[model samples]
Target: MRRERVRRPSGAVPPSPFVRRGRPAGAQQDTEADPARAGTMGSKQIAQETFDEAVQENITEFEMEPEEAVREAVLQFESQGVDLSNIVKAVRPPASENGQRQKHQILLTLESLAGAVAERDAARLPQPLAALAAQCREQLALRCLAGRHGAYPAVLSACQLAAGDRQLLLQALAALAALLDGQPDLLDAAGRELLLRSLREQQDAEVTLAGIRCVRHACLKHEHNRQAFVQGGVLPVLTGAIARHGSAAELVRTAASALRVMTFDDDIRVPFGHAHDHAKMIVLENDGLRVLIEAAKAFTDNSAVLSELCATLSRLSVRNEFCQEIVDLGGLNFMVTLLADCMEHPDVVRQVLGAIRAVAGNDDVKDAIVEAGATELIVLAISHHLGQPQICEQGCAALCMLALRKPENCSVIMEGGGALAALQAMRAHPREVAVQKQACMLIRNLVSRSRELCGPILALGAEGLIAEARAAHRDCDDVARAALRDLGCKVELRELWTGQKGGLAQ
Candidate 1:
């Protein structure tokens, strides 16, 4: 027959102060404490029975540590035949402090829950880890808004309990981060102050990365935290992470995201306005742009990485201060180089175009891009996406930005065969009313600046121009009506007033 051994610790004690159940069935020799009850054996027996019942009912609740609870919850999730949607909730003591439930208790419960979900054993997770993530997200939002119950440590611990299950944990952390991002005031002054300091002090890359992820979400959700981030030296730490720990993709991405978030804030941007020189000097000192440029260059074949890097660059390109830094880091040259090499990836091309438009606003920069042969590429992209109005619009805007300041380069545009393409794009794709609109807008830009610039567009044959406008007028788009209005009287009146002898059309 199989035998089971009871595994009680040698020094373990029973629940009640009135009755001691530690003694084995017959080992109760310490009867001196109950002087009056020493002789009354039935009373101790009755009290011991009640204590055993209470202990059995509340076994898991009063015995487990917060972290351990988190682990158990995750384990339960990983256990066989567990239903995640229906997590077993543990009962705790009623709220005693300030008439409100304590955050630590809630945190412990959640920690246990997250731990159970993160457990890797092939037992079917009771509910999709997504559900737990959702709950944590909701709790995080509550905590951020007005709960003093839990702090970042609690959230951080819960996330840690989810370690090893990167995907689910990432989502959970992201949701929590999003809430914190929305509510920076949720962090106490000490928490706010420690955000960067602790990150700097931590030698572990993972810890630092996690902190950055938190900051990224916080900045994404709150404007005040954004300022706090900048003040707390988030950029410097991010730069450090990128440079020293490039191998940690999450860290790299998180750091990049932090920079991206900072760049999105107008309040953040405005403070460093015309300090382009100073910004350039400070940022360039650490080779910040070089770091970002390297990330962009290395991620050429990685679409996901490319998209993220491009997003980061797009954000960085917005501030003139940062823009100057980009230029100093050879970003203009690097992007122009990428445009030359990777024109096939449309998304990458789109990002390149945006970055170009951002920094090339200056005269010297525009001239440099033209000298470097960017106009042909820009014009080509515009031509290729003639059917995609938005891309064409960006292309045209870029072209206008390029040539508007440098009318001398009008010939470069025309020489590159951009004029005919632009005019044809305007005329051929009436289905994309917006594209047609942009085409006309570009034609207007060309004509408004230089009448000679009209020669190439006019060379597309006047018949097509009038037909295109007429077709636009007949279309359903309001943009079509505006195109007709701009082209009809605007072009013909100029021709007639100039006595150029080009009536409506032959």
Candidate 2:
């Protein structure tokens, strides 16, 4: 028989306080103090007798006699009303003869249980399976903590290599995900190499998709996984997935999601909006933008994938150089069309708006946005999310970014009612710092260059918006003052807010 795997630390299998049973007998747990124990021996003896009867009854079927019986028994564990604790107690009595294969047998049971769970209905997992899963997960975590390099490959070889084993693969992936949920450290060098290797070299879409899901779980909001993925060259695989799986929405979604995670740590500058130049340049060099845009267009029906793709585009568009590239690749038009088609998903709209906000930073990209019917889209978006502070903030920022220093674009803004929307948002939500700032920024951009823009700016009640902003937010007041100075109307602004008469004529 294969040497028994090392035992987990005491209490490791149960792992949490919620478990009552279903742990491997190998995991020795400390007994808990009873809160309501009666001093009556009669009740205690009767409880013990009932338990004995239950154990004796389950012992017959819990026998792992023929290997096929073992498989059949685990598969039946879910369907029959067999108490999982009973199953363990009945079978564990033969430890001297069975201890060698106890852990292995449990693993097989879990593996089979996972397949059954996936292949069967999944609304609610049975209690036994859940408890057993927790035990297996805790056991694997203990192994990972020991720095056992073989643990990862063991899980991988068992499930990932089983071709056409969808249910087995799903369980294996779930186990890997559970192991690394908040424990990025468990992904040591060898484990990282194995995961990265799988992502890079796997030809099977199922394997690659699972690998990327693991990558998403690992890298999402975790700094360690991001660096490991980047260092291990996971990008080519991500882009390659997008390239090959143009039709498979899930594959595209997973790949795009992974790529989005990889670019998360681009915030190199503090108190500033821009990321490191190299962050977006890497995506540009890797042809990620085109790949993502293509995938997004192809899978327009897949909201999750499309949303991540838009977010990735927005992230990449943070720098001006990438902004130009996004424009060159017709990304602006894609976003406009996407927003027009899919307005029901707020997340999708939010990301698309964020990308537009970033892209509009390039004054040159402003014309493309206009040509792509972006102004109408923003007007609709603001209308869609009227009371939502971030949407209004982002819409105002995009409008102001697009309105700055472009004479015709100012007319476009005015005609599109984009300026009216920003002023209204400012009045509607004066307390939101982001809204006030973006409103002020938009107003500042509007009145900065064109003397003609001032008539429309003043007509939109911007003077009153400025006065209210001055009292509500100091930064907004500062920007409003700058906007007044830019428009040669600070004196009017001061007079209006001070309640003084003889403010300069509009």
Candidate 3:
């Protein structure tokens, strides 16, 4: 008797030998449902299948869970009577109250493997190497969770292994990192290649972290690291990470470091918001500055990176040859926009103020920063409810710096109604005594540098000025004494009190 065949509820039917051998009319649609199988069976299937098979075989050996593999490997090493206590001792973090160090246990196992690998002791190495790679992969996976402490130590252990069993160890680390972690550490070609050669196998978020961190550290240590980044096929990878993994703090820091490295030379500087002008020498614009500018503007997860970039840009702006780029990138406008939104981030404000100070050293940039309402913002910052003493101090110093560059900015400060605020701050509180001293010094500088700045200082009224001078003189504070001398008090004004000389006209 003939029996009806069972079909999948989704309407899939079993394929006959002939149907599998030859493509049916609707075979393409059916195959599309199982993408992997369909690709292997299609026209390009021969090459695709070969490639996929190789990848799967590699992953099978390398992409296993790392922590378990490492523990097992360590136990196996100990079963063979290997002593790893000393290696563990060198790398152990400070012991806690319980005296039970879980990390030390893992580290001891990995270090044992590393030592065996380094000594070319094959019997002691293989199992531990395999376990180390697996632990790296497991740690990488854990990055999705909040606690990621054990990752770096594992990587260092793997790197040690890579130094010995070049082929086995390095390949193991790369496979594990690629599959399990997007960490910045293991992304560089040299680092990845090194890892790929020595590591047994595993994954880690730290692989990405390692790659970026290696590149960054190299840049910090010497110029050769920068060349390595360019030659290692890592730049595109790092830049791509920034675009796609913008949320990762490690990735963002890596991108900034890479950009900074490339920006060292004038030819590459144009890509990072800087260039060279015939007249002014260096100029950066649009995307060049925008990467960092956008980073600074993000203001949420990566504000530290933003602050660093801002400080770097500020330094660049102050270089006489680089001022043109600052102008071209709409820096003045950006600075103003940040002032309105970034009141909570004092570091950002400090950076913006510094950049302003740099660019504003030139008359045109100064006017632009001021015109962008920097003067008004400075006044607002001085009186912010948070009432940061440093903000007032910096505000006073920035005005002094601005007044030195453009006498008109001091007038803008006065017009923005900061004069009374500056005066009030001079005696705000005991904690604000330092700020008060800065205010008095700034007014003195304004009056001494140009009579025009004195117009506003005097506009605050003579009685208040005399009271400030008396406070400075009688307070026994060094800052107050210096400020008293700086207020343009003539010897005639001093000697009249002593009666050694006739009183001058009022």
lDDT of each: 0.55, 0.63, 0.49
User: Where is model 3 poorest over a 10-residue stretch in terms of lDDT?
Assistant: 30-39
lDDT of 2 by residue, 1-506 (tens): 22332323545344432111232434222322111121221221112222323333334434324444344444433343333221232233333564442333444445454554455533222332333435545543332322222334444444434434545555566556554543444455665676676666567777777767777767654565566667677777788878987887888877777777666763222233213432564566678778877777787567677777788887777667678888888788778877888777777888888889888888889898988888888978887787888888888888887887787887887778877888888878988988988888887777676667778778778887777887788777678777767655754445447657667889
TM-score of each: 0.55, 0.64, 0.47
lDDT of 3 at 369: 66
Candidate with the larger TM-score of 2 and 3: 2
Residue 393 CA error for candidate 3 (Å)? 3.2
Ranking by lDDT: 2, 1, 3
**Residue 295 lDDT in model 2?**
72
Best by lDDT: 2
Tens-place lDDT per residue, model 3, 168-273, is 5444444334322434432344454453322113223345554454455434323333455454444455545555555666656655565554445422212433
What's the CA RMSD of model 2 in angstroms? 14.9
What does candidate 1 score in Cα RMSD to the true structure?
19.9
Residues forming the 10-long window of minimal summed lDDT in candidate 1: 29-38
In TM-score terms, candidate 1 sits at: 0.55
Candidate 1 local lDDT, 1-506, one digit each (tens) = 22232323445544322221222333232212221122233332222222222232233433545444444443433342222221223333445668764332444445454455456422322232334334446543233322233334444444544445544445445544544644454554555555576567665676677567778766653456666666666677778778777666667777876777665543332344322332343255555667877766655555545546555665555455666666666777777777767766677677777767777666667777788889999888877766666666567666766776467676787788766776666665656665555555555555555566555565676336645655655442343333334333342222327656676766
Instruction: Give the best candidate by TM-score.
Output: 2
Least accurate stretch of 10 residues (summed lDDT) in model 2? 32-41
Q: In terms of TM-score, how similar is model 2 to the real structure? A: 0.64
Q: Give the runs in model 2 whose Cα sits over 4 Å from its true position.
A: 1-167, 266-278, 318-321, 474-477, 491-506
